[model samples]
Target: MRRPDAQAREILALAVPALGALVVEPLFLLTDTAIVGALGTDSLAGLGLASAVLSTLVGLFVVLAYGTTASVARRLGAGDRAGAIGVGLDGTWLALVAGLVVAAVGAASAPTVATVFGAAPGATDEAAVYLGISFLGIPAMLVVLAATGVLRGLQDTRTPLVVATVGFTCNALLSYLLTHGPGPLPGLGIAGSAWGTVVAQLLMATWLVALVVRGAQRYAVPLRPHARGIRLAAVAGVPLLLRTVTLRVALLVTTWVAAGTGGESLAAHQVVFTVWTFGAFALDALAIAAQALTGRNLGAGDAAGARRTTRRMVRWGIGGGVVFGVLLAAGSPWLPALFSDDGTVRAAVTAGLLVVGLTAPLAGYVFVLDGVLIGAGDGRYLAVAGLWALLGYLPLVAVVPLAGLTGTTGLVALWVAFAGGFMAARALTLGLRERSGRWLVLGSD
Candidate 1:
């Protein structure tokens, strides 16, 4: 058995690289935002609308990564590297098919989606253009998701991190050159930005696919998709997909409630929510480590090892939460200034950040436990638990708008419902399940 210190080392090994890989997505969005914002308000608003759609489409399919990771890691731990590779191939193939379907749907619905977002006519036009072009990358995007899952399951976070970094650099350079053009090159405007992203995604996807194919070849795993394997993969992914969709609903509802609270409140909520999201990136890295390690342990039929790793990872989550909470709280006074100059907005942001800071530890605990169960292939429970949490959250959020809370007070009320109420609900459900020991089932089922 590995000592506690050794287990800590193992957790960090995966968590650090996972953190780097996770940030690349946000950076990609920010780069696009910066370059496209220069084109005009219409372009920027269009990008926002298009991005929201693209994110939803891609985000819903994230199970390709999480589901694949758990499946692959379990097989690897059972000393079946070839079987793991085969399972990974199945996941990759599933991603391709799913991606193609989503891209086609997205392309067909771009105009309607943009109109539904209710942006101005010019913005809607720009959004349609961006969305139409961006849909081309959906297949590539999902492939990257699945391929990254395979690597992470194999305990290879470093490769994804490297690939993501290169992808981001390419995205930034290409977006700029294509958006604004240089020398003899005429700018394609918003179209250029979309094309740049598509090209970069294709490059990244191609690279990741090649790597997975090489692994498959090395292990003598057949590259062709088995119907049974693909069916099982889809079956396994459904629960996780439900869990993810439920969580997304919770966030969207939160934002929707915030919007009803008045402009100042809404502005403040966005800033604080953004901060919370950034904080989540750090906490989620620990969860990623938990997922990989827990899956590997249980795959080897080492329930004791899984428990120990879970315990150790839980502590790390708590520690991480405390550190981030303190930072957020300490920076609250000035953090708002960075995001806005309005005194009212800044004050509201500060109040919200304080509450977020207080709940950060709870967030940490919930995130890690969620990852552990995922590694255990206990998605059914996670899906049900997510609904329970959302149910708990809805009434609490409804009260803010019903009571007509406004200004900084309304913003504070919203966060209390979100960070305090919603998060506590999540913590309760996840903690109960973690303590039940039911998720400790062994093997690669």
Candidate 2:
């Protein structure tokens, strides 16, 4: 048996690169945020709403990655490489179809989405401009997500790391040039950010497809999409989809609240949310490791292994969270400067970060356990748990009206509900589930 230290090493080997890749993935938006922030508050606020919409769609479909990882890792653990590859194949096709649908809907409803967010006039128009152009990239982004899942399930995080690095670098260069209109290219403002993302996503998608095709060939995995396998993936994925939807609804509601608070609050909330997402990548790395490890262990019929790994991952998750929380608190005063020059925006962002920082450990506990449940393929339970958590968060949602809160104070209350109330709810449910030992199903597929 691998000792605890060995387990730690194994998880880190998978997680560290994952951490890098995850953080870098968000840097694409971070790059756009910084560049557009320089254009002024209206531009930044517009990007916030548009990007929020895009992220919500992407997140809702993340079952492509999550379901694929769990299924592939399980099959591979049971010594079925072909089955693993097939999971990835189905996931890729699903992502493509899902993306196409999202693109169509988002393109048609871009203005309405922005309008619903209650952004000011300039911000709403800028949001529509960015959202319209950004829809073109959803297919590419979904492909990339599915392809990354294939490699991740195959126990190779480094390839995705390299892909993210190249993609982000290209996006930064393209967005910078297009934003400035250095040549014949007109300075497209927020629209430039969308175009740059599309260009980088196309390149990344092409590269990822090549890698996936090569894997299929090497494994002798069938090239055609299998209807049964695709349905199986969707069956496993639908519950998680609902889970993702609830999460996005929470975020969108929060964004709407921020929008109502005023332009400065909206702009600052963007920066704070970006920082939370960035810090989440650290904890998420541990969660990713948990997904792969727990699935593999359960598939191997090694319950002890899964339990041990879960304990170790929890430790790793909380440790990572503490470190990130410290960094968040320490850097909040300066990090906002990276995205905005306005004093009021910076101050609002700083206040938001403090609340998020205090709850980082709670987030860590919540994330790892959540991954463990997912890795064990308990999506149905997660679906129910998500609803319960969302409902539990509703009373806090009323804090906006009940407390007569507005502006930064309102944003702070929202984060406290988010980071404190919601995450705490998840930790409780997942923690109890883990102790119950009901999620250890294996070898049934």
Candidate 3:
């Protein structure tokens, strides 16, 4: 195949499964919403708050996956298959250690976290219960992420998709049985929902390990414990980990601010965030594609190919975002009701959706640029750019309410500032890096 044709084919092969894996993630949230919604508004609200808090905390460790994908991709491109596998093994061990730390912290601090989020008096107990149980799954969840990162770095997306599909299916089934009390299982309510997710994540982690151990595919990296390998991975991964941790903390602050606004506002924010996540995940498929392709092109010393791939990925990301935004805008009125039956809840969500629709395309570009920089191993820029953007975000979030902007308008304004600032910084960094050919040169070296 011609070079362009080969690149396109490779991107598509990776993107389709990346998209599937991305889609399955939100399905977990959507499923929780559906099952919890049947109980009461309070149940849904409590779960939403708990999830936001927990996700923010655990998401800090996402660097294990993100850093691994880029580093391993670079190794694979350098024709170091064994080295790539070794990286994956090291990541798995690191994930186990990180997950244990998070789970211990989460279990011990669930009540404090939930209370800080302004959980309603009656909902606090339930939120704590759910979070406590869910914390147990952290190890499995991180393992899945680490394994998938390895596969994606090697341009093997299909395995992750298949694994995710199986896991999601298991989650849905377990959710139905445990939450609703079918057959011999007693109804565990929200705790049951947490357990379902934990079980599903365990299944995913197991499947991924099985694939690697069984040598199911050429890309499957065998798992072998190497203390030295783990140490090296940790050193290489710390910068990215710091970046991830800071970003999650920022998001946690954002969530805390939203929760402080009111339960209704928090619910509305969650709805908007959920919808936005769906669109973001779809665009993230393209982002992951860009990350893989960019890494590969750079690995092969093809600067022009990397540049073209970055441009094409951005185009795809923006297009997907626009389409999702339009759909979200059109469906705003009805979409909120799906999450909650409360009239007040619906109204708040409707308002939030309007803001989401307006800014999603910009948000899409931000996500795409992130992938590009990551693939280029330009993590220092990510940390710097995020700090700059938060300088804009903190002030806007603080002033919006004080300036008399209320409800959705105020929230949307905050997101606009965030999306706009981040995108501009990322664009500038990428532009400068491209013009200087620094990233290309570094990759070649």
| Winner by TM-score | 1
Model 3: per-residue lDDT, tens digit, 1-445?
Answer: 5465776687788888899888887788878889978878777888988887766655666677777787777777777766666677787788878788888998898888778867677688778888899899988988888878778877889989888889888998898778889977678888888999999999899888666555424655556577887787777677666666656655666666676566676777777777766777788888788777777677767778788888877777777778878988899989888999878778878877777777677767767877887787777766766666656467756665567555656565555544454445555655565556666644422
TM-score for each candidate, following the candidate numbering: 0.98, 0.88, 0.85
**Candidate 2: tens digits of C-alpha lDDT, residues 106-208:** 8898888889978799999999989989998899999898888878777778889999999999999988888878778678787887899899999998999
lDDT of 2 at 166: 98
Scored by CA lDDT, what does every candidate get? Answer: 0.92, 0.86, 0.75
Which residue runs of candidate 2 sit more than 4 Å off their true CA positions? 1-4, 34-46, 111-115, 118-126, 178-192, 255-272, 327-354, 405-414
Misplaced by over 4 Å in model 1 are 1-4
Task: List the lowest-lDDT window of 10 residues for candidate 3.
Answer: 417-426
